[model samples]
Target chain A: METLFDQELVVINMGLEDFAKTLKERGTRVMHVRWQPPAQGDADLLSLLDKLK
Target chain B: MSKIDQANKEAVDKMMKSRPVWVDIGRAKDVIPGMKDNLFLHAGPPITWDRMSGPLKGAIIGGLIYEGKAKDEREAEELAASGEIEFAPCHHHNAVGPMAGVTTPSQMVFIIEDKEWGGNTFSNMNEGYGKVLRYGAYDDEVLNRLMWLDEVYASVLKEAVKLSGGMDMKSIIAQALHMGDDAHNRNRATTSLFIRTIAPFVVETEWGKKTDYDAPRLDLTNVSEYFGKNKATAAAEVLAFMHSNDLTSLNAIMAACKSMALAAHGVENSTVVTTMARNGTDFGIRVSSTGDKWFTAPANVPDGLYFSGFKSSDANRDIGDSVITETVGVGGFAMAAAPAIVNFIGGSPADAFDATNEMYEITVTENNNFNIPAMDFKGTPTGIDVRKVVEKNIVPRINTGIAHKDPGVGQVGAGIVKPPMEMFIDALKELAK
Candidate 1:
């Protein structure tokens, strides 16, 4: 816990790209994952996809 | 592995193994299968005359004029709306073209054959620069340039290509990726290599000499008069024309990519995208498993730097079959290889690297042949999987030339754009069914 806290924090920002940009502006290491809601937030499609999996 | 995963593997394997070679040049009417006398082939999926965008509509009008079916633009427009003329997608005929992608009966086309798959693809010969037919300009200047390409240019090139015995387009594409060409919007290196490879043969070409060639031939006997008396002058002029135009190899490369994509088509349950094209009005995609069925959505206008006189408002919606490059993995999927292209399409070098890096998230594999040196020789992202696209909520990116919204205005700019995500969702639903 002490080592973890002593090290720098790196974030993996998903969904919103601006979050990653803001983190980077604050001099934090950040990676922006271009993402969205699975099946574009369609309830029926998401359920169908879950069933298929 | 899951069934879809196995199928996707088979589909992408076929794509990677396929080798496209430039075999011949001939008139579209004589070479392309199912090409009818009055039929005109345009870009993208089936779009009616009413829904056709300005560039596509303008190209059709110009095609009619060049075919001598109409004497003027007014007559061509009337004939187009008269419902007598038949229009179909170029993909329907085992061919692909860039920009407006309008192909008429008399236009000469480059013939590319897939060595592994035994399928042939075709594209119309590229007209070099300003006020060209591919971008929808139809003045006498455009027609005259088309005529010159059909007669003088095609004749020498046909002989030169035959003398070189089939240029390996797949190899050239792989090399171009390393030499700073994404092989869609930026093709300076590809064009240079094309001119270098054919220059010797272009000089050796005997205009009137009859030679027995293996591929289907277009009878240029009548047009031999266009070559004139001087051999050196003809070769010099052809070289100069190719040198001046950086897009000389684009149409041929599009045909080659079409052959590559067609090889991956029709693999049982594969979700790999085989075609992604737009007709200015609608963007459409065809998956490997779905066969010929197209899922379409409204095309969005590209955002980028405009020319001196044009603004974003003047730019048309995304257009062209050139996205076939992205489908087979080198256009937008390999942007890191060509960082200089950012200057043309309006982005920083880091943005170019990010563009390519992001694509790997939605693709099935990395292309071994098209590796990027900037990213430590990492292979380019290849084979777009529809399921992955929906699952990850990411869409494929394309960098392209922006045509003017109004026809005959020519190209306004070049930029980056993505097809609407709804097309992928709909395609995924269909695949599930």
Candidate 2:
């Protein structure tokens, strides 16, 4: 088993798309989460997401 | 609100309230204050001709020929390199340019005045895309089109705009936002909307004076039917050019954007960004609080898919004043408004949506006027904050056309570019000072 220090650090790019490209260029492992506004930013749906959160 | 918050709010509100009027056409030296006869303005930050990029040099040569200062390209090159002509940044003169972004003294520029803010901005007219002066192509065809725009289209629009009063640019931009126009890279919708807004007035205005040239000239007394007489042919030519060039309204829209952004440029204690522009060699940004000082870094070439027969190696570094749209919260920051733009930048609809959504992270507020439908009527992001940009480590993304690396060659691709983070860091450090 590889130790934590020996393992590659992973980057989770939550929103901005430029980050993923920049991180990749610098040789970082990045996972771009498909981050969208809650329920397509619907006011009523946002309250639902808020309750769920 | 706190003092800083209030200042930022006032700045953004002033920008949002700006109402640009299609005012007039005039020579750059007469219209733009402080424009000297020997000086030429280019886009992004300032640089002398020796260090200027290929496209910029090409545009300078083209402008010299257009102004009748030089007989041909070879002579123009010598004059430009002889330390005879001075170069200044367009931003310094309340003007903006696309691509090479060259604005010369004799060039007739579209003046967009923000009536509500009591200020004005200007830009040179657009020549339909491929092999045009803006992208550094200085062929006979490009020079001919420039002459046509200067003598014909500029004269026609000057009269028509006066006849129609001022076409309300704010409402058109508001409507275009919903109709799939990011108003930057993908402006087809905005161009069409602008045409619709002005076409009726265009036909009503008289065309052509009896000039010796066979081309469309404005005849003060020769009033006629919509398409019945020679004067009608003049109006027809302007309309024909409009219909042919999808990028026709880009320069007009850029002027409007510049007017809006200029409204927010001088608010004290506000870290809101007022400009992010590139001249192919350097990318520079201005912060509202920092006055007009520029924080610059070498421009980065965009990474994207190219047009057929062109590779990344053939592409010039990113250039243009079109990013004025991004500064005022339209371009890539509103990409979700024009998801179809993904095709132009080699991305998916999801990528487009993500780009706009992500912009919210670094922005100070959302534009209440420009609402995005797909996002359930949420306002698009607005007011880039230098502090937030550095803290979050994000920069504004620009959707731009890629020109060829060598002079006289035209656009090679369309792509997205981000100004260097260093400029934001530098701005933030200065603001802290």
Candidate 3:
């Protein structure tokens, strides 16, 4: 299983604990975690993903 | 015929016809009658001035006693009611007042003229808050201080202004704005800078006057600390700056906020609000794009702590021109910069952050100078936009002082509250016009 952090997902609506647990269940190590709400009116998920990367 | 039209007309008329003249300290004598004895001038839209707030009434009574207008408060009140004394707003008379902002004919006024705009403004001497006249408390001590300000401080300022060739307040305001002051509530840095620039000249003038001045006997040590030491002086300086521009700076913010909110006015899809103001008697507001109409609700009682011996019961509804600051993006909007203010209004550091962040949902820009360091150097949210307000369903927050709804109680506590949204909706209807 791949670590969630390795897959680079920007999680919204999920708490840090739940995301970490889900990643562990998948046998993937999540690293380099940061959380911030999306900008007021931006809609580009890929750009958001690029920012996370 | 609409209320918005009437209010807009009144605002515009005041703005256009009133030609503010910048007067030299000495020349100000001619414009504002009996100004040497009392240190304050009136302000706001010129109109038929009426009975003042209780604290203002109290201050005036104290001024009357100080000026020997009456032997006591009862006598002074009787004289004031009898119309023996004329009433005027600090703005109308080219002056600003602190606290009760009361200035009788005998008061001295600091006069600043806008060289470019030809606008002039006045402010009375700062009495320092806490059971003072501006807060509507009238007593022997308040009266006595008025006497000193009139007799000693005003005279000193007059001489200093003459010797220094006149202080350019406009320059000071520009600098202050750059240094994180919205030029209303947060003015510590500006006040300090003013004293630093003028202290030398004040001392020199005292030294030059060998006879009555008694230079050696003069207490000029804290003269430069006027803003810090005296609330009136700080307010006076700001009033002078605001008056000089014909309310350009303030009106700009108001108009900008109005324009920004215009986008969402009358939108069938939105429930956003736009503007709010308290007229001392009533709190009024408008929603996005809803032009100049005001739907007023009873002003709310502010929640916060009071000075020793004072209780919330003694406070008045929120009042003053300071609300203009909130319209354009300062005051409560920038509370994070003044965390200590939370003590006055009641809140925590986290609350301050929350206040600033909440403001962003309703605003258009972030102020460059007035910033919150605790929030990682983020600028204070600048403008309150209606679209965002409706989009996020966030009500604008205001940190305000509660004055006694009655005249005499003065101020009780500082608290946070929301302006009624009904006014915004009314304004939204006007925007449809």
Candidate 4:
């Protein structure tokens, strides 16, 4: 059986703070994705989606 | 398969087969049996009256005032202390609520039905923004808003749903997960999708017709009014409210997740966790192997950013049943898919992805329904095992809103919380038995 320690880690970095920092300091690979609400949750933009649909 | 593997498979299969849909709105007393006049249901595990936390007490008082049992907070508190008012966990009644999470007999709850598993679950309505009753604020403004939601909002939604023949909640949730919402603290995408789906239905509902059959045929000022001129205002208000509150879909998502977890409950010899909740006083978890019994520990205060003028010291211990989102693989477990959640939950985008990656270590499998695009469309980790969690030394990571420690003070901030390891240790021991 493959154990947790034997597997490689792939990290998703929401931002470079706190928990992600600790993981990076320990030399784990991290991938960062800049996250924000879709279309900034704009009412006009959302209504536009309604139109498209 | 080994005995443990077979048990785990049985548990995961039920969870995957669950098809929860938001079917109706119901009063607690009507849909949930044993909900009497004095009974008030809260989040997390069962707790005694004296041991209740401040926000919880505040919610009970608010529930009393909302139900007309008492005129004010003082009278409400007295009624609660009189021992006539009963307190119970929402989970005990197939219901869940956020914050003080007090679900009273009169409140309207979203009723989610699981077609596959043949059960229905409920969650109390969400009060948008701060100073609402859910966080324990029970002033006139809060009461007025609750009354409006119960009287006006619920009726409009119920009619629109009936006219439009209801919707599939799982479809919206699956799309929301794809569109970058964890569906707990951040629901921008899901909120937009829900309002967009229902706006047309709401428009179909004619105002004044429900009240008067002979309601005057409007001599419209503008014939070009595409939406009924009278109903446009109501539709506008609903859309605007949903737009302003990013967490509007939270209650529905929770109801859906609860349905899935309910299906996973009561499987013999399975170590899968069915519920992870906090009642501000204690953190509790229920394992599939152990049935309804709760393994609890001292609740931990969350670590995250505090709103302006509030310090971490002012925050209450973790509270509410919002963890249902995480229990079925959305919320914090899918943080990598919703990097934007860090803005509300207080972390970096990197932290969000790291959290999701770490969760895979403890969970039994990834959920096919909730997929993360950033991770090559990998499903969010699902099926928490008491045994695996103990062996790996990892507790479930939770996304939560922080309430004030003092009653009626309302929310202070939001952040990440972890269940204590001790509860899992107790659950593992139970499984061994």
Per DockQ, the best of the predicted structures is 1
lDDT measured at residue B6 in model 4 versus the true structure, 0 to 100: 82
lDDT of 4 by residue, B138-160 (tens): 98878877875665566667777
| Candidate number with greatest lDDT | 1
lDDT of each: 0.87, 0.83, 0.50, 0.80
Docking class of 3: incorrect
Give the clashing pairs for model 4: A12-B353, A13-B349, A13-B350, A14-B348, A14-B349, A14-B350, A14-B351, A15-B348, A15-B349, A15-B350
**Error in Å for residue B229 of model 3:** 20
Which residue pairs clash within candidate 2?
B208-B217, B208-B218, B208-B219, B209-B218, B209-B219
Scoring each candidate complex against the real one, what DockQ results?
0.42, 0.04, 0.04, 0.02
Ranking by DockQ: 1, 2, 3, 4
lDDT of 1 by residue, B321-424 (tens): 99999999899999999999989999799999989988998899988778998898998999999877888777898999999988898898999998999999
- Cα displacement (angstroms), candidate 4, residue B176, comes to 0.8
lDDT (Cα, tens digit) per residue for candidate 4, span A1-53 = 46866889878977335767788899998766544443345554444333322
Q: Looking at candidate 3, what is the lDDT of residue A25?
A: 69
Determine which window of 10 residues in candidate 4 chain B has minimal summed lDDT: B211-220
Using lDDT as the yardstick, the better of models 1 and 4 is: 1
Interface RMSD for every prediction, one decimal? Answer: 2.2, 13.7, 15.3, 21.0
Error of 2 at B372 (Å): 0.7
Which is the winner by TM-score between candidate 1 and candidate 3? 1
List candidate 4 segments past 4 Å from native. A1-53, B207-233
In what order do the candidates fall by lDDT, top score first?
1, 2, 4, 3
